[model samples]
Target: MSTLVKEDLFENLLESAPANFTEARQTAKDLYLKLGLPAPKEEEYKFTGITKKLEKSLSNFNQAKPLSVEENLIKESVFQGFEGDVLVFSNGKFLQEVSSTIEGLEVSDILSSSAEIGSIAKAEKDAFAALNQASFSGGISIKVPKKTKVEKPILLLSFNGANDGQVITPRFWIEVGDFSEVTFLDQSISMGEEAYFVNKVVEIKGGLNSHINYYRLQNESNQAIEVSNIETDIQSDARFTSVNISLSGDMVRNNLSLNLLGSNSEGNMYGIYLLNGKTHVDNHTNVDHTIPHAESNEMYKGIFDAQSRGVFNGKIFVRQDAQKTNAFQQNNNVLLSDDAIVNTKPQLEIWADDVKCSHGCTVGQLDEEALFYLQARGIGKVQAKGLLLYAFAGEVMEKIEEESFKNHVVGLIQDRLGSKF
Candidate 1:
């Protein structure tokens, strides 16, 4: 990581960054210099080896060039029957011509706005987040005013173009005001045939008594690599729900952090990852209970086939001041192939005596008894496997509040499994 950063590739990236974020970029660069990259020896990253992949990707990386996209290409990526505002980005740059008009939301350019850009995504914590702050060229700052309730969900579409071996950074900042309610959908896809790297960071502030539901879907090209961070701060009585679905990528890593800053706040994190071929996916989440009476729950499930690999690490921290905190976490995985592998770890750190916290993880294959029972009932072996896998993954999918989105995910899972079975 140090050698890659010292190369001319990083210098070129810095030169192309927007002028308005010069100070922020320099700050991030300095932080990266100090922190470098995490190694496998680190407890948090022991199960995932990302340093080599990141170094190789950054060594040959060039800045993304402007892509000329067709209307049909964008239309093909949009969800059918979605009647909400859509924000599109090509090669990590915002495309206004294809974006829809959004009401009751204030969206501004992050580079030109006076908003505090890196307030929640501090460079001192995560090096990938710092790199995103240093290299991002275009991003948005969205604010939902107090007492406003959005009737439709907001969609953010990010598409990578045909340039091979380029590095792209996407950043976003969102603030949900007091008593507001909104749903946000974030989707990432690729139009390129060659392998590229995407580094993204998102910072969100949930105001007092606000309700925010966030959905993230990643279905990029099999040759693409991605590293993303989502940092959120929840205020008093606010409710924050995050659902993440990862279906395709060569190598994918997600870092999610939630700070329960106020009492009575609630946070829920749910995820499903389906991996095949030689793909690798890693999900790391941390929830900080800083105030008393806050509650948090997390559940993540995965299915790995062929020679694919998956990793899940969830940590919950109950501080001394958080006396009555209630935290629970669970991670479960199923391996369909002999060569497939999964590493799951659920951790709890409690400093208060009055808290109820528990965590558990499991990594195993499908139940043979269930398969035998299904086969006795006239089900084929392959069909039985698919049925069991569907039921295992459906536990997390059923938690999705949006019916349309949940059905869409079910269709994708069916399509992916239908070929294998």
Candidate 2:
């Protein structure tokens, strides 16, 4: 299947959009065309074929249409049953009634923003990120005040609407002030049985000495397709921790990039992907160390069962001027069946002489030694396997500083493994 060129996809929308928006959209289209969908020749995308996966139709979603979801969705989608400010978007349009929780955070509709939003939208280079800015229907903008710390985590839910056979794009921008701290929980869900697509981009900016903990949980139906981008910029002495949990979708693609622009900055990234049946999940991450004395650590693990396929591609780049940089990245996977497949690549490109960078990847099945130890204690084979799987996955979950949140993730993974065992 061949994908449509940007010009062909945007001809009608360009003719109808406002002058400034149309110009921005046209410029974005030109950029995407010039950098056409990245092929294997691209260094960062060499192992992951993103363009081939996006060969499906790029239909424009209806901006004016609002999707109505059942009340139960709100109950099931809540994170650990604790919520502060909740912003919900169904079928890419903001639903205000079901998303009001607390006043600790300020939320605004992205489409209603004034010229300031457009100005910020012009500087992005990601293909999907730029496309979202050019034609996003509606999203939420979250702002945390200076020196303030949110007591509860903010929940951002993106659900597929009742649109029979259409695609949706949801875009969001988040800003954290100096000395502020916040936690955001994002989930993608489906409302009806109809097939849909979600193309989302989330851009975050953390100020000096601030902290931001973000969790992305994708749990859409098997027929749904999702492509997500989470990009962050951390300033001096700031801390950014991102945990991505992928447990749903027919075809899933994730691009997570973190840029350390200040000295003494720290970034911790961890991901756990559980795939089964015929599902395919691909996670690509890039860490850019542009300043001196920055530290970043990444660990991503995948468990593939049945005939599922998993892919992990991680790249860490240390600039020539970035001295005293310490970065470590690793990817590990477990295949439960002989037919299951995993493709992993851990890459490092360093130009600085004083930087410490290391990368390695492992692709195989469960550890026989550990399984045997469990079985020797009178545990059944199914129970023994589940325990070993939990042990292998606990390393990534330990990075979550919040006790309650960490326990919540542990529960989710345990439940999934229990059903299979």
Candidate 3:
């Protein structure tokens, strides 16, 4: 599990890559060697033992290869009533034939474009991001015109097919023009029964006075492992909101970072993780208030059943020049079984003299009083538990503006609880 071993493995993987990516791949290889993987001793990764999982998947790295999925599987994965333009990727390669036609947006294949796709997601400090940039086979770039408001949401579907211990890296870049509004539904799902690993990166830039809403749904197979990074930059008077829902995965780690670079910008993040069995999920969020009159808020909730484990870490930073900044963060967890474990941390670092900031975290079981009340009304024990858990998660789900999507999420949560009970 040493850095040299990983370097050699990645080097071998890159050997078959196209000649066009030689320079970028070399840069990533060097960066990976320098930064190495984050060990359990690292403060940021203290609670999550990601190195072990990485090692297990990388041991059979040579067996990793691209997989093609059936059309029926793709059709079954789509939301029933979704009216948005769909963009599909199979094993990190964009499938244009399966994607819907986009009208008001400009979309390009990142690999085919001549434009420079620099490191906008702070790859210098994030080892996984560096690896993704160095090894990503294909990706998409989206641009929204100034003053244009997209009527429909853009659905980005990344599906992983059956593969043996293979690794997939997908990259995405999004740019919102001034005074424009856009919504995106990004999802990751696995159709494979074999063990695999996915490393993905998404970078977003919001123009002045633009509005952006993003939803990330992770529904991988129980045997899959996913590590994802999302970085966003908000300009002056812009607004950005993100909702992350994690329903399934053996090991899942999400890194979300937001930079409020312009004055009067706003950012909000909400998430819910429902885990059972031995699944493990970790969420880390960082929001930076570097300018005056910016606001940021974050709320995350988790429900752990059986021997599942969950981790939440939220950090907000207010710089010396960030006067009049308003920031708030909270994390809550509910454990249904004695074996379940949760680690919650809410942090705030303020250097400004004139700023308002607060954070709080709590871990507990379902309210007995509410459970009794529901049972008294003739509801079954399992039904009562499901209702209470749904209520606990509804606080974050209410933030979803799209009614159909919210209802779909509700159904998924109910199904998960039913199976457990």
Candidate 4:
């Protein structure tokens, strides 16, 4: 109930780590202890009290050990019927490669990485990141060679399961060489019945003149609590696109940050979240234009039903040297029930005189006239509402390039919405 619990948790985690990582891990632990976890009073975490959730869910959690998952579980957890090179991780440890479709892709253990591990997603940015850097094990690093264009998507599936309480920290480091192209589907699914806390971090680096498309899907049980940090650095003349889809979870918070560190680089971000029951979902995004001749666009939309709550905070920063920069951001939400709550804030800060930037947010109910228009054409009320809601969410949903993955997401969306035809 006090700092003793936090200190004990930190010490126990340190004692459990390998001796080889003591120095760096101790540095990270000190950083975490200095800043501590996110509380309700912190402006950045005001809407989501993730620390309490982590403490309550992971206090009595069992010690993490080697875990092996059934092949069928990995098969089902992946995108159903989707064809691609699949990498599976069970309980924060790299399990195996389920399917391999491409060649010349370099894969290594997370512990095998040195300078590349914390290069982009610096642990100094936040306490959760620091904690993950200090305690994670069995993560994996992926490298795509220069001039190699992967023809198919790479599916990375991570599943977490334990007796009752669980604390799983998984890390992913991705590096792409110059003039290369690839697509990745990063997904997480819950495999346990009781409460669990999952802290995940993903770092991505884009080489010059390269193109990268990233998709993240989070589908967890009602008793799951999760926090995910995705950080990306883009080089000169490169293109990066990321789409995050959150379908189900009890308490979920996602931090997506991007830095355009070179000239003529571009970044695009899209997200969709549908929350029901007592679920809570928070999405925080940051885009920084550190150089000239760069552009970034961000858009996120969500629908809240029942007693669910949703929060979105988007920030765009244009530095003094970032001339000729163009940035835009938008956050929109629709509340389906009276008890549903949504908090959205869009911000833009530009120090460059020659830059163009804009940000806005909207929170409102479903369209009444549009619903009536559909119902007047002999369509039932529930079906008409479904049609309208689907149309509202379609703008971002249609961004998926893979047909099979899109279809799988469509099925999950329908299953969650439960609207009649």
Off by over 4 Å in 1: 1-9, 57-59, 162-165, 419-421
Where in model 3 is the C-alpha error above 4 Å? 1-4, 21-25, 57-59, 62-64, 114-116, 162-165, 419-421
lDDT agreement with native, every candidate: 0.84, 0.76, 0.84, 0.82
For 1-421, candidate 4 gives per-residue lDDT tens digits of 1243455665666556655456777788777877777666889898998877776666554435545677777766766678788887877787655534346988876877653656688788888888887888767888999999998889887777654337778888899999999999888777766777778899999999999999888777888888888999999999999998887777999999999999999999999998889899999999999999999989899999999999999999999999999999988899999999998989888899998888888899888999899889998888888877777777887888877788887787766665546
Q: What is the lDDT of residue 176 in candidate 4?
A: 92
lDDT, candidate 3, residue 332? 93
Model 4: CA > 4 A from native: 1-5, 61-63, 97-102, 163-165, 418-421
lDDT per residue for candidate 1 within 217-299, as digits (tens), equals: 98888878888899999999999999999998888999999999999999999999999998899999999999999999999
For candidate 4, list the clashing residue pairs, or say none.
none
- Better TM-score candidate (2, 4): 4
- Cα-based lDDT at residue 216, candidate 1: 89
Every model: Cα RMSD to truth: 2.0, 3.0, 2.2, 2.0
Model 1: pairs clashing at backbone N, Cα or C within 3 Å: none
319-420 per-residue lDDT for model 2 (tens digits): 998999999999989999999899888889999999888899898888899889978998888888888888878898887766656777788888877623
